[model samples]
Target: MRVTSLLVATGVLLCSAPAAVAGPAVRIHDVQGTTRVSPLVGQRVTGVPGVVTGVRGFGSARGFWFQDPEPDGDPRTSEGLFVFTGEQTPAVAVGDVVAVDGTVTEHYPTAPEETPETTANQSVTQLVDATWQVTGRGAVPAEVVGPDSVPEEHAPLDGNIDKRELEPQRFALDHYESREGMLLRVDDARVVGPTDAYRALWVTSKPGQHANSRGGTTYTGYADPNSGRLKVESLADGPFPAADVGDLLRGSTEGPLDYTSYGGYVLEATRLGEHQPGGLQPESSRPQGEDELAIATYNVENLAPGDDPAKLDRLAEGVVEHLASPDVVALEEVQDNSGPVDDGVVAADETLGELTDAIAAAGGPRYLWRQIDPQDGADGGQPGGNIRVAFLYNPARVSFVDRPGGDATTPVHPVERLGGVGLSASPGRIDPGNEAWRDSRKPLVGEFLFRGRTVLVVANHFGSKGGDQPLHGRFQPPERGSEVQREQQAQAVRAFVDEALAIDERARVVVLGDLNDHGFSPAVQRLTAGGALVPLADSLPPLERYSYVYEGNAQQLDHVLATPSLRADYDVVHVNAEFADQVSDHDPQVARFTVR
Candidate 1:
């Protein structure tokens, strides 16, 4: 791994340091004999000093990494260096070089010839137990210079950087490669809206690392909007910043961003001109009323109640008071159980029972939730609390209709039964075929009547963190792999919408959930563009119109789109960060509308 070479070099330096005779340090040769030794294992030497090259804050405190540039042939190999943790500290940037005096300790060793890409190696590098102090300070050069300097291959155009927006994951990969090891300048970054922790800023830089299999190469000298600084990571010492966010980044050109990759990297951003404070305003100038229905969606930050029914009751009350108070609420990451599974529990009494009970207890209306039941035979969660998408609605405002051929007594897709017991029986099953159950997350659809008009509501939760493998076998290219499962979920909802439209051209429809894909993603676009379901907030500006924020940018992955007729009366009000902070990881988007 890249870090191994650095660490080996550091060991050599530490072993040879004591022999250096004091003076204006000149080139030192191997104080030790000429025989190469196996890399040091678990040596705990202390108080070596080096410059701070990088700093990362993972919420609570700042973590520092740096390099001690050694003279040529000093027996000190330039492999991995040291990292220290500082708690609740003031922020530190890239260019502000500080001397870190820490012990030379053995990092967890990797197996022979092991690659850095695997989880074992990744975890080992992040483990930090060493302690160090800031001994001295030096200012980094104002300009960056090197072969690793930002490349021109993927540079944004002269006047269009803000005109394009790429999907979140793809954008992260591209940005990572472009600025992996470069100095950068950022300006005027502020922690605005909701929580002060979420900082935003404009970035300027040359591109860095080249693209590799996992993703793009790290850009060496680009600015980070979130951290508000230029970044770098190197063995000689680094992960440093050239500038802070929100500062006027000079010597930069703006242009349209491009992301034409296969994992659907598409975004449309309008350049609103020169950077200015309080940049934009809401496009709609209408007032709102309490009687108008407000709909919110959230990925409810792992809202699972363990096994206890009482715990579920507590959870239900919270859900009712905070989440379901509005007219319609679409929730993702909900779990249920037929019973206990191997790792622990697999039941979802808390999500279903608690949520429903909470709504009723609050003296609010009842909610009808539909999910893929895993009891009979449908696949359940791998360990437990087989989570699924569910919907809660006020019965007084809407009622379900019986279709001509619809099976009212049976669910649309009944859980398949196996061996006289449901598939929920064994939660700890590790067979590859059993893994297929992960792909069975189904979309829940229901029809409700609002003021004599029938509106279709579809709630969905797609596949989670399985990493980029094609869907097993449902569709072919043009129609591809497991990604097809996501498409099918969208297609299922569209089919329901088509059915609604077939019955009446003016039929109203609203589709919402944790789609996993952004508004511009192929899966979402297939459902919204070209006179399909109209985007509810298309008239609103992007920032004011998002339900989720990630990696310094806001995205509307959880959405509420309406059929043409429903669009006229509805307007969206995105709550401020204060309100969203209490709700979930995803802020709820409330859509208020009047029934004509």
Candidate 2:
């Protein structure tokens, strides 16, 4: 015990010494001031010293962080710094008080080789080409920082970070950028989102967040309403714990701030505390009406044999438990039996059979399914994954109008039925030959008889907005080039709906699927033109209208629309999207309407 005490005293003595320096020392605060870029960037300096607080020796971000023992007392400046060694593998350890000789750089995480540019959430202040010698070893202090340390005001009113870059002290972007590479801590942070596949978690520091009627943060579409939510990025990947929405990360989470291509400004966490449930419950009571015919749209996210069986089982349970087994289900992204095998096998019987069996086992009626298999590699999703749209209907509640299935090249047209409107080909692909659907999921049109009424259901999965420029890119409110193709697909579906409406003025039509575009986009505009169809999402409160969450912002990408004649009400099911254990990335939407 005496020897141990002596060693502890000696270590503390060595670390407490004024970080022995060989040349002029520069304060970390002066280096990191109230600016998007570092003040002393691009200059080489010696005797820059601090105690190593953290070390990240993983991926492309191999570096160590240090913080001065005492801060400069300037709220607009940070006292911590990160020295990036790249592949050199610096011989340093955490808690080592060391002086570094290196070039100060404002490094952009996306384009690491190039000089820094003022792109939103792209840059980090760091020291590169560094050479450091540990003079002492002991514990280093990491000051706790949380939402209070950040700017109180929300982000810019226009929802663009570029405009607020000039005011680093006031704006959220500038404030977080100014504190880049700092050793920080967040206490009692609430996990607002699920832990994604990349081992990242989004948390909000504020208590009692405005959670939607369903779980997940509500998107008010106002200026930075969720400004307090920050991302927690794990430097050590793999074996990440799965967490649901509204969980609480209680205790001090210490780490160095980092900016990455994914999730922008993140804390590369080193020490994480315990997490507890945030009392988030899945939606239980489904839509109800005595004469209502319920319809639901769900993106199953490439379900196949090789997928996680537990997730698939939960998905089936959600359909029955949360959605109350809607009369008809418009399912998207149903993968082939062998999921991405690249063989010519395009059948999904095994996939659908298992899901149906699970649904039946979960107390739901046996659902009959219909879909046309797409040619291998024709539908764009995972490479070799031939995903397509399909429908699942409870035979007890609704009956499908059986007809011939259309091929990849066959185009189905709308026809005037004896009593109402129907498709020339049930389970037909609309405009399959159009370039707009070259590598995208084509729309599936089908006719259903519901409570003495003929209902036309169009299930579609349009082109995604993946190719669009990122919101944090050089472009503000980034351009969505993919909308053009989706617009064409929308027009085709709209034309078919118009033909159906022409045949019967009171045609009960429901268009539903993962539109892959926002409600206000041009594609939605074309889909709703002529007032023939109206998005049911508009009926929801703007704050609760979202069906998807990306970068902490809740927005709608999945939609359900109804013709004016259809007396329908919809609810965005909270079974997925907000939780990590979900079977799909999107929330399922269910609408109940009285038959015409």
Candidate 3:
């Protein structure tokens, strides 16, 4: 009793000192507990035993992950831990048995500028202000993560999932939380998302589920985030493959399960699998017929004159060959002459002139463009690069009805002329003064004549889903705060479309661009609320509906809608989103409509 009391007293004294001596051992599983957040968070845990699994010696987040060689029987509690060594290169090697003493912490990843303060991300359980000493050496035995090991259910049906007890045998997110910091393996993983600049690639453990024809998982709805999708990053900093969708990571890819702002629950692989090419190719759409009006929408991903010549060439190539030279193109993210430089320039004439010139140079038609310059720094996008939407029309196929009196704040109203509906000001802004356009790109409404039939086009670059909580956030049904602004933006566009329809029942109005929200979302629902327009993408084959790829799930963000009069036929050109070498993150969409 006396010896135990003296040792305990000595340990308390050492806890305050810089140095720590091993005293009274605790299990790593106990420190992890069974909840999404560590129960022992903010409490000092002494002598937690683990074998060093991996180390991240670079960047602001320098840390080492270790796992207990002998894991506890309960699958609910994790047997591994991460010791955050802020900015210091940790001197530790894999396979070393060590005893750690530190405060158990629940670390949440967030960027306050984008993500709202109310929303919460899944907290990573870690050991901070830690002191550790090597006790011995051991080999890291990784547990296999596959269809059998990973459950079908992604998370519980409904509720705040953070406080819920982990059910590794059932929920996929729970399974990942249960194995946090633990070494895991995936055999013959199928690539769903291409390898990004950060050397991270996404793969699916369970294949043939929610599978798209292009060897990727389609994120069709919010109900299922695709439980099979797993993110992998190489820890060795060695030569890793830049894989595309439908490729294969051939054998035994082993790593420690980690959580970060770099997409939740990543597998930092110490051993990367052999890269196997899947030979996936891009799909091209056939050109529109002589009578059909092909109007395509492409988000040229913040294109500026100063960008890489190859990128501009690739975009031009996609426009000319892949998209089959549409009569009218709605281009988004067209930055000013000085791309991303914070010099207060808002004009994008040089940018568009270069692109139109590029298309002409690429054996395409001589397309002319028209757009209004947005207020400097008022639109939300890359700082200083005032990104806005513009229209590019091939003068040979269609003629612009230049009504010329539109500015950033001037609203364009539909006026009746010659038994047809015409805009009060062609190439006008839609209700720009409304609060809906706050820090958002205002919709550009333009009037064009295709073979004597007038067509009204609304080029929109709505509020982005930038600040929404991630799908795997701490809160179930993660908060989509960005939707509120987008919904309002949708209503404003709908109101403008309604006005045109009210003036003339058959307005020939085409509301198209990067709507930023899914077709089933509330923002999109508001767009088609009164049956004023119908989404052309909805008419596509189930597997072929996607225009964007996010986290291995091929989804839709760009949309094309028209009044009931002009039923449109749409094709999502799969040139960029599926490939590792992409000109833009979004794929160009070509919608063909026949005018009376």
Candidate 4:
């Protein structure tokens, strides 16, 4: 329950506004205004009457929310406002009716890690320099708004934030934006995602959604405008337990509407109802098969030397304890030894060595590693952090075939193996010079021998969706321009898979990595064209197929795709993605193949 310091000291100058004085009386709706930007912004107003709904003391923006007992009659304007009282506690409490005075301010509460280009300004509208006089104390009544009006339909298909801001009711984000600084409620809320480290919950009241075969929501190409999923921010200070996907928030959730840079519109909730677990567990059982050679793909999330030793320990334990120490592991985001220092150092042997030692400490067998270091700055990731894909094989269970011509720029081709085809370059890069891989992590191809069977593995870390617009941006659905690069990368990988299969029709080939796109995306379609190769995740139950959750949708970005001839059972380990206290941002995946 460690609250950040910056949020605790945000409004000193604003709260210090010239000693409280009698000011003009105004309605809550008047202060709310009818547009995205409040009309009364920067003006000091007083004598605003309302009932105290809740008090928040955790973060930097300490304050209490009040709701006008009487309606403003205009559906576009909200009848509630948050009066910033800073880190100090307020005299008023929930359920107390009072009259308050404060300066209207529109401010953006951006997190420190945000870049200048991505940091949105003036996103949240609030009341500052507040002073309130309590008149009476009584029970507060809750509003049941859901099923009928909790979430409005339609997001602009065209990518235009201006149109959304101009017409607040026309888009989903605009509709929520219009109700900024208001006490809102949602009834019959079902948890769409787990509670994160920030104690935020994502829920939706919509009955019909594009659910996976397992009843969990899937990322169906575009962000669904019709889905009623919304983020609920917990303002209280306490230990928040994780909720399962599809769990229910019994009764309702009530809070003041607030806008944040991460998830645009959210309800800073004063009250969240009971949680019912949907039988979701924190850890996934190891995949089983006697003749099976277990394989896993994990994006260690930029693991490098000289970083937090505890994080490296946890990641190693996750690989052994949670993933059951697969025979072969395809790891992404393996950074250089010096980490994010711009020293032009491009070796990762020490980085891999520490991880191997930790794995042995965690009771897992010592794993042999292989990878080719890319030219400095050639791989895209944290600047000075040259992240690349690597492999870790248990020498006891499998053997890495040593071949020639393995380097960063060399393209590995299929060669003859024992009754099958293996990679000509034992460990080499795939299409490094292709424009698609520029400033992105190139795919690492490795050849391994398991039980007299040759398994060709291509580990990849494709271009991310960083260039895509935000889901709540002006553009309704938000354009995914990064898909173009990923599609090209997929096509290149698919071509290699096709070549391997052509050399030997029964070639056992597995492609794994952080595709950085959904299973239903165009890139996936390109990779699995003609059913030559199939996503192993498709073989699992819909509810159990996801390896990543973004904006409340449980979907697979980390995939394990194998040729049609390979028999395998895939499991997206439920170890990291669901918990905020995770070693990595992604969930690792394990697939057991019956190769003999």
Candidate 5:
């Protein structure tokens, strides 16, 4: 779940109903006034009735979620109702006008801004606990209409509204924001794409699974909101109709609707139009056996697997498209664990086999991974999981060569001592005096024969927390000196590169990873010698050299640097910053290099 700034400041407090008898119901006016003033926390007040504005089945079986507008009439303040386990009550359809008597609770609000006003008013509000019992039901409400009827001014306001009314608008706006300026839609209508119809199926299987599960599957299709041409995977019994570039669809609004499958990869129906021409496909295709290949990298923000395998299946499509498409893909934030039980599964069985399978299904090649073993005795977030780096290569274009010390089957070297100090002895707050630090994976390096030439690829995910802080930096620095640890990681990579240079003068190297430091940092300078790796496009300006765009500023934290010889064959055709919504925090950076 995305955490907004406001939610972060006030810890989400939960108030439970009284045993058996249920808590007393309180008027909305009473709670609203107190919540606004002191924000009562963990208080169990009950009995408030409001129109059922919206209802949705949570991606998992966790239960249904409904939203109700403030009874006092302020749309800004809405209650997000979660009917969790044991509340297997009837499903609430959209617009089903029902009065519910239940507890008032606060979900984790995202972090609030550090401004003086917000910081000073960070008191949390508690909800009254009353067993929500549905009183009555009726046809979906009209005021809670679909996306087409929602005004732009009311888009971000969260209340229970007609699912039909809100969905299309939300879908359209999100798509518009995601695809701004890159492509245009025809007739501004909707049509189906390859993956749209199959979203429900995908979500049911993998709401938030890890990237390594092989059993995981994904579907791709599109939808035409205006024309009501919604094509989803299950909607059509088979393959979807072929669509070429520039096909225009008609008759759709921007709203959230479930497009089920019709026969032969067709959409059953569409409620709203997210954008024109339904779904998006790459306009340009890579020619088969082309002399050149495109290499890309992305962080795939929080691509970790949930405790359940089902959540992972839901997210397969986004992960596959974002991180697994390139000829040589490097991934950061990958987890490795060793123990009897992991995420409720056997340790030996928890590898990301599902993700690898999803990539192969998408016509991408298979992946091979290397990770550090967690220490025997360690205490932290989740035991047995280690964050490391891995690679997925197209076997047709690349072959692995065994180094004398590091064979094909051998694992990458473990930098037990970071920046010339042991993990326990490191001067950082996060891991200070932690002996199990070696168990934390550092960098994974390998030799790949790309286009008949050997290229050394090093993939790393550096320390993010525990960095030094500047007094006024927009984002607070890590308390443990994350800045220092990151520098040590950089030095480690450089050391690896220097070793490679000694092995073969003509050895081509490409350093691809999430370094945590931007392209302009002193650490990067120490590694690349002020653009010595040779900037791909001198004509493109420095601002465009970034792989991640955040807060209106472009930061080149994810990078692809090549040795001097390898630099001659490739030109930075273009880098993709578009997959921020579907896949990760960092967009994939793709560079096209002609085989010399």
Candidate 6:
């Protein structure tokens, strides 16, 4: 928006701002106005008064944030502005008062890596194409964020988030919008989200917002995404601590709040709080009783044979120590022998063999695995990974019904054998041709014998939430586009379960895996439709239910469901999701049932 004169580009008039507006002295609050979007957007302003509060000297988004030292006293309008210099580092330092010349712009940002359609993030109001003159230095004021300021309600305009009036006193999102680019503080913050590879973590300004047992904020529903939850990333040099959930960032974490595509509203902190260990430990589910069969579901994040042997060893220990070596484990994201190398080798025997071998090495039961190799490039994941779902069962505890002729394309159906329910092909795919399973992992159904009773297990890895808009994206409530395919997938799996239970009304069928949707989501609802299966996640305490954490929100993406006929003792083993040095992104869930 640097055009000084009217210019035509591709037969379209491209202009920065009205020259009349450029001459007038407009304050930063006047530019930001009282809305999620700036009212003065696309208009050029001269002498927009503010003091440099924060300077982002690195990255592709180099800029300096300035705030008005004098307050407007309006709760809705923000008194701060971001002078986006693009890749050029800003010349001004913090506390230097400046008068700027720039065009007000609404920057629609995106997450650094949006799993879904690279959706547009909620617009971050910025002053672009700018030049500034240094005035006298001024004090930078930082407002404290707490329950007294931010509201319990998150977004006022749920789906239609942008261009709306900022109700700073009513909604938390609006309150954040009101403080855009301004210095803010979270005091004595509790680390709710574990520290990631990128020196960033999530903390809570308002504690007790569905605070999980282990300090992290629990996302109970779509309505309340925990407005207190704020992502914290340090602007100061030195390494960010490997902070886990339940850890404490004791004391003040002060910084200018900036919105990005990564997490919705981020506090690019100039001062991080003291790191205090919370002593949060990975949990282990109680071992199965002598007559009980324990089943677990874990997504070993894209594990391949060529991956570090330590990774396999870690996963093996998670199976043994964290999940108590369940009798049967349904594993997701098991890659082929050569991980991520596009040579078209689809067999995962070596990959699965290494995992089972590692389990034995870790002093776990001698586990045998069963799986049907999916056709190359058919099931979608990492391009060359060909990740698929497979089962690992302890031979000493349970027996796999190895009916032959199961392949990638052949669908497994329920059959009656010896007056009990069994699968047509023990290790067969379910409805691989369905449109629901297109570019997704097909369901793998297996029949098993536990204490002389027939048991059927259906393992599924649904289409990811990769195509859905983030919660903090432009759209309110966010668009779950991937849910369409996942819902269809749930239906396909539900139909399979229905057929199995139909064959035997009192049959023991366990449906589990990385369903990749919350228990409250439509996909999960459809999977448990008609009461064909009961979701075990729903039965757990809300604070203890989550199996995955993303962007500071502790949520569930993996589940164990069972038919009503089987009594279940279930626990979600908390291992990877809350820890920094995790082998997998997901924590495995184990369910036990007495068969004899």
For candidate 4, report its TM-score.
Answer: 0.82
Q: Estimated TM-score per prediction?
A: 0.52, 0.86, 0.93, 0.82, 0.44, 0.94
Global lDDT of each candidate: 0.39, 0.75, 0.86, 0.77, 0.38, 0.85
User: Which 10 consecutive residues of model 4 have the lowest summed lDDT?
Assistant: 1-10
**What's the true lDDT of residue 487 in model 4?**
99
lDDT of 1 at 301: 47
Model 2 lDDT, residue 445, Cα: 84
Total clashing residue pairs per candidate? 68, 0, 0, 7, 99, 7
Which RMSD values do the candidates have, in order? 13.5, 5.4, 4.7, 5.7, 14.5, 5.4
Ordering by lDDT: 3, 6, 4, 2, 1, 5
lDDT score of residue 583 within candidate 3: 89
Q: Scored by Cα lDDT, where does model 4 land?
A: 0.77
Where does model 3 exceed 4 Å of error?
A: 1-17, 20-23, 111-119, 157-160
Model 2, range 424-528, lDDT digits (tens) per residue?
888888888888898899999888998777898999999988767554443344556888999999999898888888888898889999999877778988989
Index of the highest-lDDT prediction: 3
How do the residues 78-170 of candidate 5 rate in per-residue lDDT, one tens digit apiece? 243333323232344444433444444333222332332322111122232233444455432122222333222212222211112223234
Predicted structure 2: lDDT:
0.75
The count of backbone overlaps in candidate 5 is 99
Report the lDDT tens digits of candidate 3 across residue range 32-112: 898987777667878788889999888877879999888779989988889887776566779878777877777777645
For candidate 2, the 10 contiguous residues with the lowest summed lDDT are: 1-10
